[model samples]
Target: MLTKTVHSSTDAYTNFTRKEWASLAYQASVSLTDEERTQLQGINETVSPDEVEEIYVPLTELLYMHTKHSVNLHNDQNRFFHRETKKVPFVIGIAGSVSVGKSTTARLIQALISRWPNHPKVDLVTTDGFLYPNHVLEERGLMKRKGFPESYDIRKLIRFLSDIKSGRKSTEAPMYSHLTYDVLKERTQHVEEPDVVIVEGINVLQVNKKDRRISPVFVSDFFDFSIYVDAEEENIIKWYVDRFKVLQNTAFQDPNSFFHRYRHLSKSEAEDVALSIWKTINGVNLEKNIRPTRHRADLILTKGEGHRVEQVEVKKS
Candidate 1:
C-alpha cells in the first residue's frame, strides 16, 4: 500500500499518490487501444490500458492547459510589440536514469498529447541522436562514458532546440540506431513546426560546470515543462539487467547488431556482463549526472516495483 502525504504551504513541491493524481483526469478522458499502448511501451516495459487512462490521460490534459496558456501569453507579447503572431512549439524535457522507463513515459505522453484536438502535431525526439558518434567517442577515449554529458554534441542540441523555439519551418536532428549502437550519419529526423516537441533523454537535465561557464544556454532553458522519472537504484539495476538479457536473446542475434557477439554468451555469462556494465557505466552515470538533477525538474514521477507510478511530485509555482 502507498502512504499519502499532505503538502505544506512552505513545501517546495506538492506530493500526490497515484490514486490522487488519477482523479485529476476529471475533465476529459482519452483511451488508447491495446495496439497504441503496445507501440508506446519500451522493451521490458509493460504499460497497461488502465495505466494509460489513469496516469497519462490526466497528464495530457495538464500539458494541454499549459500549451494553451503559453500560446495566449506569446500572442499577448506579440501584440504588445506589434509583431506578427508566430507559433512556437511547447518543448518538454524528460530526464531519468537509463532503463528507468523514461522512454516509455515520453512516448506515452507524446502519443496522448497528439490525440488532443488542440495539438495534433506532437514530435518526439530522443537525445540518443545527440550523442557523439561511436567513432568520435572512440577517438576521445570516452566510449565507456557514452551517456555522460561530455559525450553529447551539446552545441548541436542547443542549436536544434533554438531552431524549434524560434519557429523555424523545418529542422533536422541526427538519428541514432540502437542496433548499430551509433548515429546514422545518412539519416535525420525532420521536425516541421510541431505544436509540442518532447525531448527525452537521460542527460536532459544535466548542468555541468563547464556548461555553466562556457555555454550561454543550457538544454533545459528551452523547456516549457520538464519531468524526471525516479525509481530505486536496485530496481533500475534489475530492469537494466533484465533488458540486457532480453536484448541478448533478441536484437543481439542479428548479425548486423553491434552487440551480436552477446547472443552467443550463456545466460549466466550475459547476466554477469550486464551487471559489470551497469556497475561501471550506467550506475556511475546515474549517481554522478542524472539523479542529481531530479530536484530541478518541474515534475517527478516516482515508481515502485513493477514500474508502477506510485507517487508524483509537482514543483510549487
Candidate 2:
C-alpha cells in the first residue's frame, strides 16, 4: 500500500519522501532506460537517472494503468465498442506554472510511455494549438494574456478533445507557431488513433470560467490521468527570467520571431522584462487559476529549489 504523511500546516496534503514516492511510482508501471537517463541529464540541471526512475517512471506506469482500465471499462460497458472499433485514446493532462518544466515533463512522459509495449502508439499535443489566433487575440485586445484561459477557444478545444475521446478515426488540431506566436490559419495537424494522448499546458485543469454552462465540460473531465508539476512561486519566477534570457539570446534574435525586439535588450533589461511579464501575466494566472487546481490532480510532483522533484503527492482513489 502507498504511504503518506502530512508535511505542514500550510500544505496539509499528504506528502511522500522522494524515495518512497519513487518506489510507489515503480509499482504503478514505468520502465526507465539508460538512453532516457542520458537525455534527462542534459535538460535537468541536477536531477539524476535514479530520480527519474523513482519519480517519473512510476508516474507513467500509473497513467498507463489508468488508461488500460478506462479502455477496458468503456469496452465492457458498451459491447458495441469492441476491439474492432478504435479504442478511446487515454487522455492525460499536465498542468503547471510557466517555466516550471511542465512541457518537458509532458514530452518526457510521451516518449517514455510510447516505449511501453502495451502503448506503442502515443501522441503528444500541447494546448498551445488551442490558443486563439494572434489576430483574434489582438482584435480582442487580449494578446498580452496569451496563455490565460480566456485566450483559448475553449469550446472548440472541448469539441476537438471530445471527438478524439469518442474514438474518431481521425481528428485535427490547429497548429500554432511559437516563433511568430500565432495560429497558422491554413494548417492543421491530423491526429490518428493512438493508444495515448498527452495534453500539456499552463491551465489544463482550470474549471472556473464566465461561461457557466460550458464550464461543466472543463478540460479535466477529458483526462484519464492528470499531473501537476509544482514549485515555489519565487523559483518559477527565477526560471522564467533565466529561460527568457536564453531565448532572447537565441530564438528571439530571429527576424521572424515575435519577440525579436527583446533580443536587443541588455541582460539586465531583458531580465526586467521577463520578470515583469511573469509577475503581471503568468504569476497572476498561477495564483488565480492554476495553483488552486493542484488538489484536483491525481498526482503532484513537488519540486525543490533546483527544480528537482523533492516530494510527491498521490491522491488515494
Candidate 3:
C-alpha cells in the first residue's frame, strides 16, 4: 500500500479542506431528510444538512466501497478453497474524546449507510454497554475514571465483536441507561447478523493489543474501517461543559435521574461543577488515553468551533 500526504511532506494523511471534500458529494447516493438529521443530532452540538452533504455523504460512499471489496475478497478466497462460508459483518469502529460528537457520527453513518441498495442491514452499538456496572466501578474505586479504558470489560466487548465478525445470526448485548447511569440488569439489545456493524466509543481505537496483559484480542481487530472524531482540547472542554448545562435543565431535573441533585445548582455552581469534572476526569483521560489513539484511525474528522468539521484527513491505502 502506498502512502502520501496531500500537499505536505511531513503529515501522514492526505488532507482535505471542507470545500474540497464537499465537491465529492456529487456522487452521494443516499438521500436524508431534515427530520432524520434532527433525530441524529447530539445535545449541544450542531449537525446541519450542509455538514452531512459535505462530510458524511462522501464518507458513506467510501464505506460502501470498502464493504463491497470485502465481500469480493471473501468470495475469491472461498473459490480457491473449494468451500463456502457465510458473509461476515463489515465492522466500523468510531473513536474520540467525550463531547467530541462520535455518538452523533456513528448514528449519522449508520443511517446513511443503511440506505445503500445492496445490503442495507446496518446495526449500531456503543461500548457503553460493555462498561462495568456502576456497582462494580464503585467497588473497585474507579468511579472517577468512568470513561477510561480500564473501566470497560474488554474481554466481553471482544467476545461480542468476535460473534458479529463470525456471522452469528443473533447476539445480545447489555444496555446502559443514562438516567440510571448504570447497566440495566434485565435489558439487552439484540443484534442480528447485518451487512455492517458500527461500534462507537471513547476508547474504541485504543491500541489495546500491544500489551498482551491488557487483553488477548482487541475489539478493533475485526474493524474493516475506523474513524476518529477530533477537536481542540479546549473546544471539547467547552462543549462538555455546555452539554452538562443542558442536561441539568433536562435529564438531571428528573427526580429519578442519577444526577438529580445537580439539577438545582445555580448557574454559577453548575459551571463550577462542570469545569471540575472536565479538568479532573475527562481532560485527564483524553490526554492520557483517548488522544493517543487518534493516529491509529484510518480517517480523522477535525471539528472546529461550533462542532462543524473543518477538515478531514485520510490515510492512504
TM-score of each: 0.94, 0.88, 0.94
> Which 10 consecutive residues of model 3 have the lowest summed lDDT?
1-10
lDDT of 2 by residue, 133-207 (tens): 888999999988888878888888899899988989899988888888888889898899777888988878988
Give per-residue lDDT, candidate 2, residue 310.
88
Q: What TM-score would you give candidate 2 relative to the actual structure?
A: 0.88
- Candidate order, lDDT descending: 1, 3, 2
- lDDT for model 1, please: 0.88
lDDT for every model? Answer: 0.88, 0.79, 0.87
Q: Compute the lDDT of residue 145 as modeled in candidate 3.
A: 93
* Total clashes in model 3, counting residue pairs 3 or more apart in sequence or in different chains: 0
How many backbone clashes can be found in candidate 1? 0
Record all residue pairs in model 3 with backbone atoms less than 3 Å apart, i.e. clashing. Answer: none
Give per-residue CA lDDT, model 3, range 95-205, as digits (tens): 999999999999999998877777478889999989999999999999999998888888788888888987889998878899989988999999986888899999788
